[model samples]
Target: MNDPYDNCMAACDACAHAYDACTAAYLAERDAQALADCIALDIECAQLCRFASGAMARRSVLTPSVCALCAQACDLCAAECQRHAHDHCRRCALACEACAAMCRAVA
Candidate 1:
């Protein structure tokens, strides 16, 4: 995918990895409300990171705008995940923070 985003690739990987972790947590925790919320945010952040990474990869004109939105989402998702103490939540928060930082760099 055009080598992905040099600046965003790590964040993209983090988001993707966090999504998997969130899914596993959802399955393990089974707390419909909180886990579901975390899972939903994880999925959203992952998808956005993927899209933003792809956009950056293609050097699209819309990348800046996309990155802006990515930063926002990642920030919110990170905050949400950080509210909990679970390992998965902590990992997700870290990933989101990384993604947010990358997005901010290019936004």
Candidate 2:
């Protein structure tokens, strides 16, 4: 069977990448609040991506809803990242955008 989890995994990868970038950026700039927010979102998105991927892989009925939530999270994360004009934020925005697309597709 073709893997539906492919998209989920992609989202997961993007989320994780974005999360790392945001964390690094926050740490570098010492923007504690932004760093905290990004980390929280990143953690949430990462877990969602992992769950969505695993659920999809197992053909769980909850995949769509989970993907939907992932989409929302990615969107928010992207918006937040876009506020800063740094490389890390740019990268995070891109990843979040990609993840959002993937999540929308799955959802």
Candidate 3:
């Protein structure tokens, strides 16, 4: 059966992937030290999105709570990413925004 939160799950998954890529790219940059906060938040947001996606997929009772947290994490991640001018950060920010919106819809 198709889960009601499938779309949100997909969005979360995409956001996780984007965050992962952005973090990796940032780590390789010359100013990696300056982006420490952004990298940390990206990793955290990715993990939260993954967890929320799993909870939603399983139709867990905690889905709402998890989704709400995921939205907040995604929002923060997006803001952090937006502070940088890198293409990867910009892309990740966009993905995070979309994921946050989807999570909010079901939160």
Ranking the candidates on lDDT from highest down gives 3, 1, 2
User: What's the number of clashes in each of the models?
Assistant: 0, 0, 0
Model 2 global lDDT (CA atoms, 0 to 1): 0.76
State residue 96's C-alpha deviation in candidate 1, in Å: 0.8
Regions of candidate 3 where Cα sits further than 4 Å from its true position: none
Q: What is the C-alpha local distance difference test score of each model?
A: 0.82, 0.76, 0.93
Residue pairs with clashing backbones, model 3: none
**RMSD in angstroms, candidate 3?**
1.2
Q: lDDT: which is higher, 1 or 3? A: 3
User: What TM-score quantifies how close candidate 2 is to the native fold?
Assistant: 0.81
Model 2 lDDT per residue over 1-107, tens place = 75766866766676776677677667777557756876677667667767766777778898889888878888888898888787878887888888888888878
TM-score of 3: 0.95
Candidate number achieving the greatest TM-score relative to the actual structure: 3
